[model samples]
Target: MPLLDVKNLSVNFNTLEGTVRAVQGVSFSLKKREIIGIVGESGCGKSVTVRSILRLIPMPPGEISEGRIMFNGENLLALDQKRLRGIRGSNISMIFQEPMTSLNPVFTIGNQISETFKVHQKMNKQRARKATINILEKVSIPSPEKRFEEYPHQLSGGMRQRVMIAIALACQPKLLIADEPTTALDMTVQAQILDLMLQLSDQFDTSILLITHDLGIVAQTASKVIVMYAGKIIETGSVSSIFKHPFHPYTIGLIKSLPRMGLRSQYGKKPLHEIPGIVPSMNENISGCWFAPRCDQSMDICRKVAPLQKYIDSDHSVSCWLFN
Candidate 1:
């Protein structure tokens, strides 16, 4: 069985304006020790989907309106708070996008990291502190002993991010959800962080769900890719297949938007390609295909009837009227 299976998951938010259907029928599977990338624009629900897997969404405003999240033969959606807590840090861990906000300002780095070990591994305070220092060193944090007493605000962005990674890896979880882990870092630091994550994944045999808007990062790290638009997955395939032969118009647009190494000189200062039009708001009741309004190849059917995912080959699938 796959390490994680998200089936027909839908997430909604109740706001003053209206109910926002943020995630719509999103489904994917992550195999053992494989890295899967979820890529899309800002409001495409990539973060929401991953947060839902961990039951992190606040119920008063947000809800898992439909579907199941199965991890290791257990349905996370069906689990109680106590049961879910048991699985959260020990079995599945998440590295959120922003470290400053995610980390507690009042707690020392060692306290926070050691808390994971204390709660999940049942380690004593001293043992947990030792383990926390070990994790800090593993993530290549210099002067782990000194940094242990530092608060989140005291560190640089890169260093703060490394501390977050250390906490996430404290328990050696089977699955790791990294949501834009390299955001706001310099190119060099970003590369280093990615390399560290790859090394850790190899050492721990961890299955990673990497959520990011950068296709370049996806190309570098993921084996399979899921392209989401307007809270729905539009295309999915092996990384090479999606990169080389994108079948959906939305996927094609996204790939084209990337600045190629040689294409810049060929264009001679021409503007980079952009996917025209903005992503539709979740509160807007979009009929038929959500991408139809922006799709160049959209037809009458695309505006009237939503297309189901159509398999092109053993590994590639696209949701579009053209495929139908």
Candidate 2:
């Protein structure tokens, strides 16, 4: 059975204007020790879809209209808040996108990491503190002994991020959700963080749900890929399939948007060929395909009817008029 499965998940935000549908019928599954990457432009529901699995979206203003996040055959959506909390760090842990903001500035790193152990395992302070230091060392945080007591402000950006990882790993959860974990770090540190995550995955045999906008990073790490656009999944497949044969027009455009090694000179070393239009507001009721206005290959059907996800091969599927 798949370790993690999210089916037909839809999320909406009750804004002052109206309900903003953030995630529209997103679905996928992950197997044991497998790494699935959700890649897309910023605000494409990459984070929302993953966050929904954890039920982190604030209520009153945000809610899951329809969905089921099945982990180990249990539908997480049906679980009450208390049961969900128990499952969050014990069965599923998430490494947030920005550590600087995510971490508590006033609390010492050791205190924060130890809290996870205390909450889940009911470990005493001394034992939890010892566990915290050990986890910090495991994540390759330098001076783990001394840095444990340091506040989030004392550490470098990369170190702070590693501490975040350490906290997430402290519980030894079955699945890890990393949402743009390395987005704020420099190139050198980004490599280190990615390597650390891969190593940890191997060590723990943990399934990972990685949410990011970087295709290059996705190419390096993801075994399977799901591309999101304007609150909907545009395409999905194995890494090899998605890279070599992108069936969706949006996926093709994203590939073209990447900076190629040999095309730099021809492109005058300028910025990339960005997708022309901004994502349409959720308040706007898109008549047909959300990407129709931006797609170069748009046809009458593209403007008149929203396309459904059509299978191209055994593993790959795309939502675009070109396929049908």
lDDT of 1 by residue, 85-201 (tens): 999888999988787899999999999999999999999999998999999999999999999999999999889889988988889999999999998788999999999999998
lDDT at 24, model 2: 91
Give candidate 2's error at residue 84 in angstroms.
Answer: 0.9
50-141 per-residue lDDT for model 2 (tens digits): 88888888887998999888999999999999999999888899998788999999999999999999999999999998898899889988
Name the runs in model 2 displaced over 4 angstroms: 265-274
Give me the overall lDDT of model 1.
0.92
- lDDT values, one for every candidate: 0.92, 0.89
| TM, every model | 0.97, 0.95
- Tell me which residue pairs clash in candidate 2: none
**Cα shift from native, residue 281, model 2 (Å):** 1.3
Give the number of the best model, judged by lDDT: 1
Worst 10-residue lDDT window for candidate 1 reads 263-272
- Cα RMSD for candidate 1? 1.1
